[model samples]
Target: MSSRWLRPEVYPLFAATGVAVGICGFSLIRNITGNPEVRVTKENRAAGVLDNHAEGEKYKENFLRKYVRNKHPEIMPGINKFFTDPKY
Candidate 1:
């Protein structure tokens, strides 16, 4: 009777449903707490400021940040040089 509910074939369906529920729950929690990507302060409430600090935090956590930080010379050295280099 109870064993009927514990079939091997149902495990994948259960796992997938769990994952979907988890994603939905996470999104609901984030929506309730306010998205970190959007900066809403007294001054920027109406227009919503560009949250560079949050963006930087996100970048710092990225998988590439660890390798890129040590290997890359600059964030965009060529473009920076093109703009900053004196034109004579």
Candidate 2:
């Protein structure tokens, strides 16, 4: 039997191919499984943050409407026009 594990030229090709296959397989498995650490908590945290942002926006809009009504009644028409404009 031949002592050489592979022909000198073929060994480097085989090594490089094996490495490429390993990397591809690892990436496939990682994507399929996903990052376990962030799975559950990440979704919950994102939902909570989105809800907080929405609430903050509602508060700001309410404040702006009330301020506009009390301080600058004339601006309300402009505001309404701005919002209702086709460009918007």
Models, CA RMSD each: 13.4, 19.8
What tens digits encode model 2's per-residue C-alpha lDDT throughout 1-88? Answer: 4657656888889999999999999877754455322235555546543435564555456544866666644647778978888886
Model 1 lDDT per residue over 13-53, tens place: 99999999999998777554565554446555666556568
Question: Could you say which candidate leads in TM-score?
Answer: 1
Candidate 2 global CA lDDT score: 0.63
Q: Which ten-residue region of model 2 has the weakest summed lDDT?
A: 31-40
Which candidate wins on lDDT?
1
Q: What TM-score should be assigned to candidate 2?
A: 0.34
CA displacement after TM-score superposition, residue 64 of candidate 1 (Å): 11
